[model samples]
Target: MSRAIRRNSLTEQATDALLDYIAERQLGEGDSLPPTGELAATFEVSVPVIREAIAALSGIGLLRRQQGRESVVAAPGATHLSRLLTLRVAHAAVEDDAIQQYREVVEVGSARLAASNRSEESLRELDDALADLRAVADDESLHAADIAFHAALARASGNDLFVLTIDALQPLLHRLRRRVWSGWVNSGGDLTSIVEAHATILERVRERDADGAARAMTDHLAQARLGLDVLSGHVGDSPARD
Candidate 1:
């Protein structure tokens, strides 16, 4: 009745064992991991194997390589997720479609949280992001504001998971926004409309209208997607789109 990850190789097993080691010790962020030799001895593996596992862990942002060639536990963050999302969007796999869908769900939840839990400082931050959006004279500046505003909104949600998810989605969101905005620009959708949609979401959040905030976010994303010429997946897998 033991359902466990079937370790297909020594390195795979060592990776799992290292995760277990961290969990068992309740290692806090920045806590020093056992020395490479100690870990190797505990796992009954060569130092090379332990080093391999540590490398893998670092790649995923779960472990930090400190100065003086030391390793420490790391607080989970979005760096790994951001890299993977950037690659996934660039490759345009079928699963890439699901990421857009996943974002909608996460962002809607975040919007509701922002409406319910936002602080005055968070509202001011949102206002600053909006002012930046209105001041943008070019698509590039608009895109920068677009990224910042959503990030601010997520932080206002008072949920760490929401903040991290929004952070990780930044690159992909930027790509999608660029694509959508280009099509919208050619088709007569103006930056003012985009700014207005976001303003509605912000106003709802400021008013503490949770339902209104969620609905506003959903509508905003739908409109943004609608502006895209075609929902093409994969760069070369499909015909070139505008």
Candidate 2:
């Protein structure tokens, strides 16, 4: 047995220790969690507390329950966060526009860093993602491709924190992307223009022009925001989202 957890904070302390255990072992997605009994012994906490900690981690998408009997580490993604963001936006505690603007600011910086630090493999990934974007004809596929392209750039920035931060925002991004893209398609907007915007950013990344990449991304998002506004009937006079 190890240090006994205080009764009042047992679950929280065990949760932190569990996270540390995973990190110390460098556990990745799909890795089996050590048994709860073992964890209880390690933390000198009751099995109930260990279970509580597991439940909390699972709720955050850090862990997954398999067959309702086993727990596994989950792959890093925005799966659970999307719901939380959607609900928060629905409740009006946070404005959707603010979230979109935040993404623009963060992505602009990420694009600049990507231009400077992107590896050859990352460059290839960007190329592939863009290629996939160009091939998708439907709005849904296009939205997915768009998100993938941005995610690729985030990873290319060579900053894991940036990548994770952006990943967490994907749900909201996808929401806006889908709405704007579908509206554009319905309104007879040109898909080629959207592809070209991504291409411009990719070209700057390839040329290692950080300023150009950042500027291209800024312009792209500005256009997208305009389009989203039009879709929501807020820009009846200005047609945007090209």
Candidate 3:
């Protein structure tokens, strides 16, 4: 057994061992895995434990299994994460939860930094984006521009981690934005109201009011969630997604 393997949970040990093996061997997609018996022996665990570990990895699309054959490494993609986000939004609409809490933290922290660090040029860029969002008739275009605006704010934070985190979150955020806007439109909420909410956030940032910008962003997200809930006819109340 590797010295790094945990002595506690067999599942944890199995998971760590498989990940370490993949990393050390530089395994790639479609690569045949070693036999489960070999993995069981290597980890000093039962075949069933190893099987459970493989099943977990397969669930994440990180491994593929064949009858009477070694499992194969799989190409990991964003599909799993996208599904997670869909489930999260479906749950968040009805009950305030940790995901919403964490999202607020990211949004407020990024907005505050943006307010303090944004340059005149960046502000102008945001203005143009807002204008484009207002003019776009297609919901997809509007949602894309909205994401661009928020990502620009993250970049303005002058923090590389913040920028990367926001970038990684772009896909899910774009999906959520579309859902929210579609709901708002169906609920008879004016598009101008949504655009003006974003404008207020930008205005606060431009004025260098960090606290005000953070609050505005929180409000904007809360309203967005409500709008989505109404539009989906409470479909967002469920905590699971297909």
Candidate 4:
């Protein structure tokens, strides 16, 4: 039996109740939700209230609605997460350093996983992205290739969540990278070492050397940290590239 929602905040309470119901029932992506009429009865609310609640859930990527079909559970992808993250950043709820640190943890783990689970197709994709990165000179071209390379690396991890998360964060990460690139250019640094770092990581993944891949990624991120600091307006001598 569903618990009755309080009347004080019908839509908000119904939304919370629906979320609890989904979790209690262990609903997975694509599981069809009960019809709005049925949900209204279950929550002891009016049908219109239930509709509004469903709309609220759909707004946050928790539900998918069809014109005449029942709504289904949704798998929050890059678009949804990016929207939420952008909102949080705009409100100053999250800072660039927090984003950078989170990426380092996820990406290092992704490198290790990719070394063990990467497929030939993913390897080829990474190689192509790296090739493009090596060849691109303009910031726009480099940004596109850089994003592709990171996305490919995360995809190679064979974890959908990692792929979703890194993809969502790429826009934020690009801002940091752009700052780093601008500083590097002004300081007369070349792209050779950056390309070399990625090559080493891909080679380690190809050899199935999980530990080596992890270490290489750690080193690469350490270099990126220098640029991220610069982005945060911490002026200092640029870190030397190998």
Candidate 5:
């Protein structure tokens, strides 16, 4: 018999062991797990290592801990995922050209999915969100409505992974929107222009034109980037010739 390789590090092993214990024992959310000391001894690692593993999982929303009490397994939610997305986008923004390309790809894919999967009810919801956005055009309320509209489009994609991925991206999207909107307001760029862009995208989605919707969304994002760049004083409205 061949010996098996230990492919995991001690911290990973500890985390997996705890997770398996939770699953095998049918521990639901809010249920207390074993003490860290006990788990460390069981895994034959230092207590601090186990604590570090627990902390990592906790940061991802998979566990929660209280000082002097046993840690508990918790269901993951969008909050931690949102934070992760924001960090990812902020890091990407440091390399603006590369980030813009990636953002274009994601926006196109999301628009196609929205066109293909959106039902009448979901489309209506999107329309309602768009109306709300128009109503709140000059205020913070528009930003919230804008987020809701995008979220609804993600949900309409009919893929749980797509929905979750977009949900995770919400924080970054919100931050970008704030920057863009503020810049637009300051530069005297009409908010109605964005509304019209969204309306055009929505119409394509309603018509089930996946390619058209995708193209529309890409154009909208490009315009948004222009507004943001102008606001940040990084570039003029006119694009430079290559």
Candidate 6:
């Protein structure tokens, strides 16, 4: 019996104990957890309390529960982070520039890695995303294609962590991309140049030129910064357009 010593709230204590149980047993994705009754008995809590703890864990993607089946450890995902960011943006809890800066760090590094690690399949995905981006006339579809391009680049980096972070950022990036692109259009900016920027990055990555890929990504981000500045009234027309 894995006894849960009460430290704070009973539910919290039970949750902690449950986590300990999982770690102790080295449970992994698809690994079934012991029954609720067994957990309740071990934690010295009522079955309802144990269920509450399980629910809390499940909410965060730590466990998957189903009717008539034992709860299993879940495969990790960005779903919780994605939802949290979407909600934060909804409530204005985070700034767009902050999000953009964080993206600069993650994506620049991803572009660099992708140049060295990309496969034929990832290159094909990037080509498809770029084609969609070039073809889209509407804001919604353009933003979707832009995100697909970035997400595919992140995947090409051959890093699971990068893929997860970019996946978590997709919803937020879609809104930001729409805002930036719309602002640029409203300011008489050429959307063709925007597509060309992505094309340059892909060209460098496809050539396996790591430093060139990083520089292309950096330039792309600089252009986005100009768009953001124009949107925020920090600049009147992007100087890059001059």
What's each prediction's clash count? Answer: 0, 1, 0, 0, 0, 0
lDDT of 4 by residue, 39-87 (tens): 9999999999999999999998999999999999997779999888887
State the weakest 10-residue window (summed lDDT) of model 4: 233-242
Q: Comparing 3 and 6 by TM-score, which wins?
A: 6
TM-score of 5: 0.71
- TM-scores of the candidates are 0.85, 0.71, 0.57, 0.86, 0.71, 0.88
List pairs with backbone clashes in candidate 2: 227-240
Better of 2 and 3 by lDDT: 2
- Candidate 5 runs further than 4 Å off: 1-13, 16-42, 46-52, 64-74, 85-102, 185-188, 232-242
Model 6 pairs whose backbones collide = none
lDDT score, candidate 6, position 102: 83
Quote the positional error of residue 51 for candidate 3 in Å.
Answer: 25
Judging by lDDT against the true structure, name the best candidate.
Answer: 6
Reference-based lDDT, residue 142, model 1: 92
Which candidate tops TM-score? 6
Stretches off by above 4 angstroms in model 3 are 1-101, 231-242
RMSD of each: 5.4, 6.4, 9.1, 4.8, 5.9, 5.0
Alpha-carbon lDDT, every model: 0.83, 0.84, 0.78, 0.86, 0.80, 0.88
Extract clashing residue pairs from model 1: none
Candidate 1 local lDDT, 1-242, one digit each (tens): 98888646788889999999999999989899889999899999999998899989998889998767779999867878888767776677634346557767888898999999999999999999999999998888999998899999999999988888789987777777887777666666777788998999999999999999999998877656555534442333534333
Q: Write the residue-wise lDDT of candidate 2 on 1-242 in tens digits.
A: 69977575878989999999999999999899878898899889999999999999999899997775669999645657666666777798665568768878899999999999988999999999999999997778888899899999999999887787677778777877877776565666688988999999999999999999999999888767766676777776655443
Model 6 superposed RMSD (Cα): 5.0
How much RMSD separates candidate 5 from the native structure? Answer: 5.9
Error of 3 at 211 (Å): 1.3
Error of 4 at 45 (Å): 1.5
